[model samples]
Target: MIGWREGADRVGDLRGRLLDRVGTGTVDIDRIAGRTLAEGLDAPRAVPDRSHSTMDGYAFAAGDDYPLAVIEADVFPEDDPPELAAGEAVRIATGAPVPDSADAVLKREEAAVEDGRLTGPELDPGTYVYERGSNVAEGERLFEAGERLAPRDALLLGDLGVDEVTVRERLSVGLLATGTEIHEGRSRDLDSPMLANLVSAWGHEPTHEGSVPDDYERVESRIAALAAEHDVVVTTGGTSVGDKDYVVRALDALGEVLFHRVALRPGKPIAVADLPEHDAVAVAVPGKPVGAHAVTTLVARPLFTGESELSTVEATLSTDVGIGPAGFTYAVPVVLEDETATPLGHADSALQVYEETFDPSVLSSSTRATRADGFVLTESGLAAGDAVDVVPYPAVER
Candidate 1:
């Protein structure tokens, strides 16, 4: 893991990452709530004529009667439905629209319409009928750009009678994992789940997910094919100067490498390169588990999903952290108290085993972590009382 400064320097424009060939698409309004404006092709709908209810009640000026008030009835949303003259009441139901001639409504339970005359107990003003346009105002901006549309967003659009929307097409980032020693889980042979996982976060899905086995030709072919099929391409492993690192050669073959390495620990091998398409950027990360995880938050997140840059909040250290590496950065995990954070362990590329819990399936009832909150230890050494920042892991929610 890289220090806070090293991680911060690798982030890209938040909005630019969202600009990967988005276009109008059809989606029910319900899903828009959690989705960003870039994913939802949305447009404003013409205001719809809605009614408070269809109830017909005594419409009369409020406060005119305490125990009894002179009332008139008859109101509808339509033009010229009926008029309530002075000192008279109109019988309305639960859903009937209040007549323009009426100002307030006396509920049927509260008033009695007997023998063509209405009488009701006294009530407060503005008790019965709904005010006009109380639900929505005329000419209101429903949704703004860069906002994620949620279920309510879709419902609101439907309520507004909007059918079609103009939106950019969701982005598609190509996923490429470099290195020969890197291996996916047991079931995956050619599938790159790290790349595949980017789909949901990055606004697009992967068309291909195959790892390059440290061979320049095989890696180059996969990257080229994916780059052609998707907006952006990502590669894991083979990013450092190891003999098996093939990402450098593959990227050089495809397009120009913007930057080959970042001055950070754990993820120092990270490289951000340009693709053939506009706004298409590819990030190459190391093969280590922690390296890939850290790189995802730093380079992958912004390049693919346009998510907020890695955020840091203050906490106190739980243990003593001795950082002897000179001029190097480290991402450490800490146990957070009310505002104090406790260092969990030393965070290094090869030190992820500390966070892993025993696989109950493999060894049931093992004394390992069942759950943990991911925390980052700054490059600065820390002690039990030292201050730190706790960034919740992506898998865990605060």
Candidate 2:
């Protein structure tokens, strides 16, 4: 009987609890993408550890005027050139270390070289010179704890001489889709595949336990066994208070039910349970496709990634979206176009799969949920031009 607000608040608690039980592993920086940072990473030393020249040119004391004697040896990236004496300069290439006596670099194009002498326009000190540790200082925090590693972030870490990083081990999730209809092939078990892909996209391993029938004993045995084998167990269907809903009953008998329901339209039947016997947490999402997707993104994703902030974007609604019978909040799918969030199937909508209806009932079907790129959550019906926060699909950008 929890309200949507309370349910959403509890999501943070669930995330903290799950993350506390998760394990950590060391991974090569190249393979660390999508993994959670178990500890904050700091720059061991300043990047570009030494002062260097940024252009292929002549390096000399800024106060040295007129023709300066060019050093016999050229300074390349790997060479350590001798210090410039009075009225002396050295030919330095880009990325080459600057001699301690030099404070400025004159680009080759700007310098006049003749007969072992080089001359250039007088410039201020430090011009065209890259100072030591300019990019990052020593011991600066590079990434905070709990940050999810992105590919680019890993690349940057690699550039900083970090070959490996400690990251949270990816969890092994057991996916189960419940319903006698699916078991009998009367209805296709779409939830299993969808949930599996989502779990994979979130950097976890998904072991599809297959669809379970409505029998009480089988449900109990399947859940208990999967819980024993996996770090987390996720089931779709049999969460609501229906005569055939044996999943919840089995979970209640086998574990501690953290919460049974959330006040959310198309997804109110969500449930979470802690199975201490198997050392795993079990999450039950609604059988309806959109409902399952929403709960997984809002609740399950944070648990896996250890992210506290929900991802969302602000956009203007293109048309009036009804929210009648307003006891529950709604996840209204919409197509974004030209910075505006047009209701699905509108004249200017960007997505082609949207139907004209805004009813939550349509989301109950597995296929209809695919018709949206993302959705807007609102407690009251939205009028045209109202600004709303849209949560996109966790893996898809558009």
Candidate 3:
């Protein structure tokens, strides 16, 4: 088995290969949220375009003597600022472009205007002024290729007069659950709906292609059909080496299995493959619900989102949690409170499946473990009060 980091790296490599075949398109700024930029974007023009007032005050050339002549024309946001002569000031509202000669703006309340003359405190150059190119300079790189665009990015793009952007097309993913229990209605297919939600959250289109029994032929044929219909096929369950576990075997027969398993506890059975014949990729997740979620977010996520880094929050461990194995990296679920993380399956937690040592096997199947705020990935045991980096669900979910 390989390490989880290597698994993520392989998934990232798959992302690059998939991107080359997916293509790109132009999208309006309104519809660009959650999309990846296909090419770098540079500022066409400088922000503010020209020097403008940051306050509703008077614009005057600094270093001029007191009691300067006040210009009659007031500058509004839409009006062209009238030229100011030496020892002259003009009324300027907030966001109004300052005259070319003006270098400072004095607040209205601070200014003394009497007998068509203006007097204010001593001013320095560029005070109370939004300087030209201060926000964004022309030819400055605004966004780089492969950066995912968020809704907040629209504010900057719209201010820069960018109405649309070029972004890579969203991946079309098909979710297939494999299990005799699920196919026979004896067990509910929990992983498919969750995987579909995850795929959608990762900015991809996910279709629940339904489930197939443990039969190798059925699993192989269904996977092939799904691969033909989607850019990616995500199969849940039947990833282990058991006789009934046929997802991995079917993938091996249909394509090239990149990696069979990772050294991740509860989620080690996850597998990734390249289905070149169908021009698609396959990700086989373990049957365990928690393990399925953990591995997909840590490994398969990069294939769709093009991101490998985990955003984490530092917290104090509330209790000592021991790992059964030293070689595998364990993802221990925890509930966060006041910067303290309490392992979810601990004796003190809501789910008491273990005393001190974490029971990943049982915790992976516990539905209550889903209430965890985040998880701590560690290879060794964690002592109480130790500082741990918790990867929050929100950080990976969307």
Clashing pairs counted in every model: 47, 0, 0
Q: What's model 1's overall lDDT?
A: 0.55
Tens digits of per-residue lDDT, candidate 3, 282-305, equal 999998999999999998889988
Worst 10 residues of 3 by lDDT: 14-23
lDDT of 1 by residue, 99-195 (tens): 5655667776667765566677765555666665555666766566555454556666777776545455666766665555544433233225644
lDDT of 2: 0.79
Candidate topping lDDT: 3
lDDT tens digits, residues 1-398, model 2? 67755665565567656666779889988787778888899998887778899999999989988699997989999988787898999999999999988989999999998999888799888988998788888899989877778888866686588999987778889999899999899998777888888777777888988888998999999999999998899999998889999888888998988888876776788888888778788888889887777766665555566553657888888887666476777777777777688766343454333334456655556364467767887888777889898877654320
Off by over 4 Å in 1: 1-23, 30-135, 145-148, 163-170, 182-191, 201-203, 243-246, 249-253, 256-266, 277-280, 309-331, 334-371, 376-390, 394-398
Q: Predictions ranked by lDDT, top down? A: 3, 2, 1
- Residue runs of model 3 more than 4 Å from their true location after superposition: 63-67
lDDT of model 2 at position 81 = 70
How many clashes does the backbone of model 3 have? 0
